[model samples]
Target: MNIGILSDIHIDREHPEPNRVIEGLVNVIEQRGVAIMIIAGDIANDYERTLHTLHLIEELTEIRCLFVPGNHDIWNEKHPDKTSWEIYEALKAFSGNLVNGPVALPNGWTVIGDIGWYDYSFGSSQYPIEQFDQMEIDDRVWQDKIKTDWGKSTIEMHRYFFGKLETQLSAHRSRKIILVTHVLPLSDFTVQRPNRMWRYLNAFLGSKQYGELALKYSVAYSISGHVHDRLQQQCQKTVFICNCLNYASQWIENDDPVSEIARAFKTIEI
Candidate 1:
């Protein structure tokens, strides 16, 4: 089986006619001979559009599509009345969402996923934890600070996901695990810049504990997004992958939507 993986499509950030984005995805999936599509995160900024696009991809390609919610995916910007948790539940309600539970695959390989929150472990040591908590740097606020109201500190949220994911990993410890998350688990996947602004931004990018968990549970593939960088590294038994089809302006290799998506689209044989 070919498992197609990619993250941070950010459809709303690029295509004016959303159908074009959906069509591009379908075309790529077909061309790649993907048996199952696993989107790591950030399909779109709004939950509704995100869900709609996932549905369209599954509908058009006729393949099982699974995904975790990125920070942007659960944003309440368009629907201010809904809390981030509400948006989360809404996205998880979809049958294809991996957030619901682990999906068992053939030959003892199982996949588990979640929108793991950042724990400020990725931040620069120069900044205090207090500063990371502020969720602002250089007078610019991290968008999650504005768009999401989880009603909990970032640490609390990270702990919640950590515990939940640990339980899932423990249950399937004997199987070949493929762990997916919206946030980067390893610093190797983070921005390589040593500048202050990036360091501050890096604080919210991800957590080292996730990488720790992958090793603890002996995960075969630790896949994630939100860093907007395409990086892959092998540490111990796990292969960390971040294949983000970032903002259109950030695209350097390709200009066409289908080509961009195709270029970032990665596959693993199961």
Candidate 2:
């Protein structure tokens, strides 16, 4: 079946027109014989944007929209306590299926998806914070936080986030799984951006654990968004796609941006 995969639509600033992007995507799906649409996070960054997106979702009761939360959707700047659960609640209010782990679709295709963190190279010369070095510190903080469940708890943090990925993969064993995440497991897709933003996005959106998890499991493809620039790359045998939902960048990069990028939703048949 044909599915529309959309990501990185940062509708946080779109205000009353936030639904326009969703409607644009929906129209593309309707015309392209697409049976469903899978959004790989960053749909909206705030409550107002979420409400606007939800209002449109309420109108769209026919199509199946599967989504995983992106880092920005949960916690970007002001809202630090925002979890994936809160995002799910917001979407559920509009009858959308906010699947955290692996879930089997009505069409028999299983999906393993989550808002995964960025995977960093511990030994890379450019990397200042090594996972090995951080692990030692993380362990100490984790032990103390468990006594009181404070923000410094590494085990709790890992369990709450990365652990869900493992659980999801195990649950969907042997199935033809379409994995979705906001993080790029490998650094290939992220090499084009500025280092500081790259590091920040990587810490929150990309993870090697997620990559290894994908490789260990029966994943067909991994879709993601967070890096605003769009490109197609591969890690081992897996296809990694970063989708750009904004037309602004396309315009800046080209004189004929409309003809080049088209600012339209895409339908990738699997």
Candidate 3:
């Protein structure tokens, strides 16, 4: 079965709503006979935007759209107000299939993945953070919170994320499996944007550790998005497609003109 993958639309409340792209996307999916549409992450600029965009996405098509969250989804500066779990819950409520692990799809295919966070660096491997860019840790005390928080603590969170993946994968080993994420697993597709900060974020968001794990477990394909520039690459046997916005829109006022950006979404056979 064919699946159309997209990400980082970053639709804000301005200019073109997702309506235009959603309509075009629906037409393309129908024309291509794709069975599913996977929106990896960054479907909107924020939480409220995600709610609006998902409603638009659902209205424009009958195809199932599985979603995930990106760094921006939880990058809000407020702690008690914008915790990662809060953002996750928003996503879960908006998209019934916001996959944090493996889920069975139509036909014999199995899907797994997360709109995962950057694997924050530890020790000597860490990226330099500017003094002005201090983390937003508000009144939330780390010591007081434990199992309830997902990204507040150690690699234990990642262990849980990956652990769920391993379990779901183990249950369905024979089907064609597709992994979807918001961040690219390798450096090749990630180097497109000039922002070093975003590049660093992309590098650590989704674990390269899990990328290899998926390959080891016999995944057929892995799709991702985060950096706006479009690209494609491969790791061992798995194909990685960094399919960014199907079309650039005006909400990104400083981005390339809409016509130029829209050209990138031209269809490709799977």
In model 3, the clashing pairs are 117-205, 118-204, 118-205, 119-204, 119-205
Global fold similarity of model 1 (TM-score): 0.97
Question: What number of backbone clashes does candidate 2 have, counting pairs of residues 3 or more apart or in separate chains?
Answer: 8
| Candidate 3 per-residue lDDT over residues 1-270, each given as its tens digit | 666776776665243545555555666666677666777777654666676777666666666777777656544442456666776766677653556456677668777777654444311145444311233234333221321335544345556666766777778778878877776665555544435344344434456756766688777777777767667666677777777763344224544334333444433234
lDDT digits (tens) for residues 111-175 of candidate 1: 99999999998889988889898999878899999999999999999999999999999999999
What's the lDDT for all of these models?
A: 0.89, 0.58, 0.59
Descending-TM-score candidate ranking: 1, 2, 3
lDDT of 2 by residue, 163-235 (tens): 7777777877767778887766656666555454334334433556666776777477878777666777666
Candidates' TM-scores?
Answer: 0.97, 0.73, 0.72
Q: Is candidate 1 or candidate 3 better by lDDT?
A: 1
As for candidate 1, its clashing pairs are none
Show the lowest summed lDDT stretch of 10 residues, model 2: 141-150
Model 3 lDDT at residue 149:
39
Q: Worst ten-residue run, lDDT, model 1? A: 14-23
- Highest TM-score among the candidates is held by which one? 1
